[model samples]
Each structure stands twice: as C-alpha cells, then as structure tokens.
Target: MATVVPPDLELFLTGWLRSNITDVDGLQVGHRTPDGYDGSYPLIVVRDDGGAQSADRVVFDRSVGVNVCGWTRNSPKDCRDLAARVYGLLTGEPDILVGFAEGSSVCAVVPDGCNGPYPVTEDAPYCRYYMTVEYSAAGIRQS
Candidate 1:
C-alpha cells in the first residue's frame, strides 16, 4: 500500500520567502526564532502551526506563522513594512507551488486567512510583527 506524506511547510516557506523577497538585502529568515537572537536586524521567522490531513491522505491543510522583527530603537514602520510585503506575496497569488525533498512537492498553496503584523512586547529589544496563513497542499504518496 502507498501512503501520502505531507511537505514541511515551515522549511518550504522559509526558503520560499528568502529566495523570492529580494527587496530586503541581508534579511534573515529561518524556521525558528532563537532566544536572544542578536545576529541581525530585520529578521523573519517561519513556524509550523500544524494542520490536518484528508482521510484519503492525498491532501493536507497546513497553517504557518510568519514573524517579522526589527531593531527596537528603530521605528516600528520597518517591521510593519516587511510584514506587509510578506502578506502581499502570500495572499496576492492564486496558487503557489512549493517543492520539497526528493521529487515531492506541494502542488498548490491557497491562502485561507491572515492575521497581524502586531507588536511583540516580550522581545523588548526588538519590534516584532506576526502573521499567520493557511495553505492547502497536495502531498506525495509513497509505497
């Protein structure tokens, strides 16, 4: 019997945004936002918010969280601007193709919903904005 395997949304989105968004040079993007990450300003973090697989296992509905962080001393506008760019890219397109390991790929990505480029008070040293997006993906089947 064959089984369907879902693509890693976090990794795909991280790489996708990093390669596609060329406006911001030196922007750091990753799957996780480390504790006290002091490497650079204007960073983007991608997180897997988890999702559901269809009963037939051929489709997956996934949610991803994207965060934009800027230096605290700087105006929050920078963080907001980056967040807006990400949001536009994700939602503006009708369908996005995300390729993963071995020949496996997400055939389509549909934006279900989006929330906030809001502030993060916890990370006091940096201004942060968070956004969430839902994706409908076609998984790969393997025996």
Candidate 2:
C-alpha cells in the first residue's frame, strides 16, 4: 500500500503567485506575515483554512486564505489594488493546473469569496485585504 501525503497549498500558492502574477513586480509572498514586518510596502500571506478529503482519500477539498498587506499610513488603496490583481489571477481561469509534484497535483482552484481592504489598527501603518479560495488537489501517492 502507498502512503498518501497531502499537498502544501501555502507553498504552492506562494510560488504560483510569485511566478505568474507579474503585475506586482518584486512582490513578497509567503505563508505568514512576520510579527512586525516593516521591510516591504506590499506583501502577501497565504493560510490553510482547512478542508476535508474523500472517502477513498484520492481527492482533497481545501479552503485557503490569501491576505494582501500594504503599508500606507494614509489609505488602503494600495492594498486594495494589489488584492484586485491577485483576485483576478486566481479567478480569471476556471481550472488552473497548479502543478505536478510527487505524483500529485492541484487539479482545480475556485474563487470562493473576497473580503475588504480594512485598516490594520494593530499594525498601525498597514492595511489588509483578504480573499478565500477553494482548492481541489489530488493526493500524493508515495510507495
């Protein structure tokens, strides 16, 4: 019997956005935002919101959260704009073949919903915009 390893959506998304989204050149994409990240103006963080697997464990349905952060003391327009670009890329295509790895691949990515460009009072000079996406991935088979 082969053991199955679920796909790492965070790594896949971070890399996918970095490679595909050309709108924001030099954008920093990662799994989490540092405690006091003050180095970059615009950055993106990906989170696994969790999901379930099929009875046979061959298919996985995942919920992922994508947060776009912009450092602007005055307004959240920067974050909103960046978020729009990210949303466009993710929602533009009906079926995106995320990639193939370890005999597994992300079969589909569907845009679930999007939230606002809200002010991050705790972060003070930063604003954030978020979106939720659903990813259907094929389980990896490791013998």
Q: Write one digit per residue (lDDT tens) for candidate 1, span 60-100.
A: 88777888887663667777888888877665443533434
lDDT of 2 by residue, 64-132 (tens): 788888667467777777887777665444354454433335677655533433434554566777777
TM-score of each: 0.81, 0.79
- Poorest 10 consecutive residues of model 1 by lDDT? 96-105
Top candidate (TM-score): 1
Per-candidate alpha-carbon RMSD to the true structure: 3.3, 3.4
**Whole-model lDDT for model 1 versus the true structure?**
0.72
Clashes by residue pair, model 2: none
| Model 2: residues with Cα > 4 Å off, grouped in runs | 23-26, 94-104, 110-123
Positional deviation of residue 98's Cα in model 1 after best superposition, in angstroms: 6.7
